[model samples]
Target: MLNKYPLWKNILILVVLAIGFVYALPNVFPDDYAVQITGARSGTEISQQTVDRASEALEEAGIAIKGIDREERSALIRVTSSDDQLEARPIVQQALGEEFLVALNMAESTPEWLQAAGAGPMKLGLDLRGGVHFLLEVDMETAVEQRLEATSSQIKRELREERIRYLGGDLSDGNNIELSFRSEGDRSEAFDIIRDRYDEFLLDESTEGENYLLNLSLSEQEIQQIQDYAIEQNLTTIRNRVNELGVAEPLVQRQGADRIIVELPGVQDTAQAKRVLGATANLEFRLAARQDAPRASTESYPFRDEPERTARLEREVIVTGENVSNANQGFDENGMPQVNITMDGVGGDLMTRATRNAVGRGMAVLFIEFRTEMEQEVVDGQVITREERVEETSIISLATIQSTLGSSFRITGLDSIHEASELALLLRAGALAAPMYFVQERTIGPSLGQQNIDAGFMSVVVGFILVLVFMAVFYRAFGLVANVALTLNLMLLLACMSIISATLTLPGIAGIVLTVGMAVDANVLIFERIREELREGVSPQLAINAGYSRAFVSIVDANITTFLVAIILFAMGSGPVKGFAVTLSIGILTSLFTALVVSRAMVNAIYGGRKVESLSIGGKLANV
Candidate 1:
C-alpha cells in the first residue's frame, strides 16, 4: 500500500504522460522556409487571392511551393529552403507590386490537429534564430527642447486668449522659455498662468530695463519625470513598430535612462530591420499662412504624401506629436480618405484653446521624419563609420477649421486610402518622445545560429545518452524504469515550453542539460533507499513502498529549494539568464512528477501487488 499507486493515481500519471506526448509531437515536423506578404503600412490586409497570387508567382519563378496562408493583415507562402525563400522575395514583390511588402521568413509546419491542440515548437531566441540586435540611445536633449518649445507655444496662445500681450513668440534657450512682456501686469498674469495651468514649471521674473522678463522652466523633479516617461513611451512605441515587422519573437525594452535594446529573432535583412524599427517620424499641427500674412514656399517645404506640392504655414506649432492618444484610418462623411486623430489631455486642451477663436482659419498637419543613414568618413587619416541624421518635413493635409477642434480631429486630403492608413499607423505608434540613433548594431548570421543549435542539440543528446546508459547499467531493471520516467520528464518539459511559446536560448539548452542530470538524481535517491530496505530483509512490496514514501521528503526538499532558486533567478535576471531560469524551473517541476508519480507507478506495476523475497535493481544477494 505504501509504494503502490491506486487506479486513479495510475490514470493520472498515464494521462499526464499522454498529454506530454501529444504536445511534443509537433516538434517532429520541420519548419518550412517562407515568405511573408503584407502592406508596407499597418492597416493593409492581404486577401486569399493575394495568397493565391503569391503561390502562383512562386510557381512561375519555378520555385517549389509547400503551403500558403492568409493572415490578419498579411499573407505567408512556404518554400523548401532558405535559398528558395530568398529567391522568392523579389518574385513575390513583383507580383504584389511596389507598395506591398515582401519579406523572407519561416513558417511552422506543425499539423493542424497539433496546432488545434495548442502544440507548437519552442520559440527560438535571437542567437538561435539569427537576427538583428540594436542598442539605441534616446536624444534626451531633443526631448527636453521639444517639451520646452511646446510649452512656449502653449504659453503664447494662453496669453493671447487672456488678452495678455507678449513680445514675439516665446523663445526657448535650452534651460528656459523666455517671455518678454511690455507691462508689469502682463508679467504678473504670465506668472499666474504658469502657477495655475503649468504647475510643473518654475517661473522667474525680472525687470530688463522697461520690459518685464519671465523665464519659465520645468522643475528638476518634473524634468526627471519627463525623461523617465520619454524612455517608457519610446519602449511602447518601438514595440508597436517592431511588431508590425511581423517578427516572431522581438525584444524591445529600456536598457537605461536613455537607451533601448531591440532584438528581433529570425529577421534576416539589416536594411529592412533598421527601416521598419529605427525610422523616426512624427506629426505637427501648425496654423496655415493667412492671405494677409506672407505665404512663401521653398523646394524644402514639401508635402509628404504628395511631394510635388509645397507646405506653406506659420512658424508657431499648435501641437507636437507626444499627445496623440489614438489614430484610425477611415473615410470621411464625403468618402474622402482621412486619418482620425485623438489627443491626450494636454494636447486636447492646447488644441481646443489654440483653435477656439481661429475657426475658418486653415491648419496644417506636417509630418516630420528624422532618418539615420550610416556613411563612411575619413577622420584623422582613418576610415570611420558615422551616422547622418537627415531631417525632412512635409505637410500631409491643410484644412480650414469648420468648428473649434479639441482632442479629436481628422486629417483629410490624403492621395489614397493607403496613405491615410499609413498616416494613422504613424499616429497610432505615436511620435518618438525623443530622437534615437543606433549606438550598436549586431547581426548574427544564420550559419552561426545553426552551428549554435547543432552544438546545443549535441550536448543535450550526449548528456541524455550518458544518463540513459548509466541508469540502465547501474539500477538494472529498476534503472531502466527510472530512465523511462526520465525520458518522459523531458517530453513533458518540452511540451510545457511549447505550450507557453517560451523562447529557448543557449542558456535554456544548458538548463535542459542540468535538468537531465537532476532528473536521474531523484531516481538514484529512491533506488538507493529501496536497496537499503532490501538489505534490511523486508519483502519487495514493503521495500518498494517504504523507499518511495521515505524518498518523497528528500525529493520534495531538494527540488523545491532548486525551484525557489529558479524563481529568484527569473525575477532578477533578463535576456539569457531569464531563459535559463525558465527551463530550470519547468525542469524541476517535471522531474519531481516523474520521480514521485511516474517512477513510483512503474515500480508498483512491476513489483507492487505480490510480495517478493528479492529484487533485481542491478544488485544480487537477497535471502530466499
Candidate 2:
C-alpha cells in the first residue's frame, strides 16, 4: 500500500485524461475551403433561391463544390479545394449580383456533438491561418475641415445668443472662418466674444472698404488635439467593426500619425473587412429648415428610402453619431423597423436645448457616408491620379417633434429590418472620427498559412520526439513513464487552449516545444533522485516516494516563476506576444500537472506495493 493511489484519485486522473482527449480531438478535423455569401445591404438577404442560383453558376463554370450550408441571412458553399474556392467566389458574386457580398471563408467540419459540448480546435493566428491585412490612411485634412465646420456652427449659435448681428459667415481657406459684420463695433464685439469664449481659435479683425470682417483660425494645440482624437477614435471604431465581423484574434492598432493597421485572422477576403472597417457611416440630427430660412443656412438631401424626394435641413447640426452611446434594432408600435438610440450626456443636452422651443418643428436624421474615389487631373501635361473623398448625405428620417428628446429616442422609416439591424450595429460600434482610405491590402493565401503550420508542427514534433527519446534512453523504465506524462501534458495543454479559445501562433508552438522539455526536466530530477536513493541500498518503493516528495518543491518553484513571467507578458503584450504568453501560461500549468501528478501516479502503479532488488534506471543504477 506504500505507493498505491486511492480509488477516487485514480478515477479523477482517468477522467481528466479522457476530457483532454475529447476536447483535443476536434483539431483533427480540418477546415474546408468555402465561399460565404451575405447581403450587401440591410435590405438584401441570402435566400435559398440565391444559394441555388450560386450553386448552379458554380456548376456552369465547372467549379466543384462539396456542399452548401444555408443560414438565415448567409450561406457557405464548401468547395473541394482552395483554388476552387478562389475561382468560385467571383462566380458566386456575379450570380448573386451586387445585392449580395461574396467572400472566401473556411467552414469547420466539426461534428455537432463536439460543438454542442463546447469543444473546438484552437484558433490560428493571422500568420498561421492566412488572412487579410490592411494599412489604412486617415484623412486628417477632412477631419480638420469637419472640425472647422462644427466650430463655425457653434460660433454662429454663440454669437446669436450674445445678441450679436452679422451679415454672413462662411468657411474660408479651408481652415479659417470669416464672419462679415455691418459695423466695426459689431466686429470688435464679436472678436472679444470669440476670443474670450473659444480658446481653440485665434481671432483676427480686418476691414475691406465698408465691410468689417472677423477671422477665426484654429490654434496649433487644438489642431493637434483634434488630429490625435481622430486617430484614437478611428482605432476604436475599426476595432469595433472588426469584432462585429466576428473575426477571431484580430489586430487593430495605430501605426503612424495618420495610419492604422488592421489584421483580421480567418478573414481570407478583404471585401467584407474593408467595407465594415473603412466605412465612415455616421448620423447627423438637424432641424428641418423653414420655408423662409435663408438658402445659405440650409442644405438639401435626397431621402434614403425614396431618392426622388428631397428634404431641406438646417446646416446647423444638433448632434452627430459621436454622441451616440448605445443603439439597438427594434420594432415600433406600428411594427415598422426602428433603431432605439441612447445618447451621452452632452448629446442629450444638445438635443434638449435644440428641441425645447421648437416642439412643432420637424427634425431630420441625416445619414452621411464618406466614400473614396480616384480622380485623374491633368496638371502641366502630367495626368496625376489622386484620391478624392466623396461625401454622400441622405435624409433617413424626418419626423415632427412631439416632445423634447432626451438621452433616449427612436428613429424609424427604415427600408427593412436588416437595414435597421446594420444601422444599429454601426451606431453601436461608434462612428469613425475621420474617413480612412486603404493605402495597402494583402491577403495571405491558405497555402502559405499551411506552410507555416507545417513548419511549426515539424518543430514541435521534432522537439517532442527528441525529448521522448532522451528520457526513455537515460531513465529507462522511469523515463518511459515520463514520456507518457509528456504526451499527456501536450494533450492537456491543447485542451486548455481550445477551451479558453486562445489563438495559436508560431510563438505559441515554440512555447509548446519549451513546455515539452521543461516537463521532462521534472521527471529527470525525480528519477535521478530515485537512483541516488537506490544506490544507498534503499527499497525501490521508498526511493520512489522520497524522490517525488523531495522534488515537488523545486518543481513548484521553477514553474511558478515561469508562470509569473507568462502573466506579465500577457498583460503587457499585444497580438503575437499575447498569443505566446497565453500558450506558455497554459503549458506551464498542464506541464506541472503531468510532471507531478500523472508521472507520480504512473511510477506508483508500476513499482508500488512490490519488493524490488534492482531497478532499470540508467547510468550507475542501470541494474540497481
Best by TM-score: 2
Candidate 2 residues 110-191, lDDT tens each? 8999999999998999988889988988889888888888778888888898899998888898578999999988898898
Model 1 alpha-carbon drift over 4 Å, by segment: 1-4, 34-104, 170-180, 183-236, 239-259, 269-276, 285-304, 309-319, 324-344, 351-366, 375-386, 395-430, 621-624
TM-scores of the models, in the given order? 0.80, 0.93
C-alpha lDDT of candidate 2 relative to the true structure: 0.87
TM for candidate 2 is 0.93
- Which numbered prediction scores highest in lDDT against the true structure? 2
What lDDT does the true structure give each of the candidates?
0.82, 0.87
Could you give candidate 1's per-residue lDDT for residues 292-314 as a string of tens digits?
Answer: 67443212358765679875688
Model 1 C-alpha lDDT versus the unseen true structure: 0.82
Which pairs of residues have clashing backbones in candidate 1? 3-545
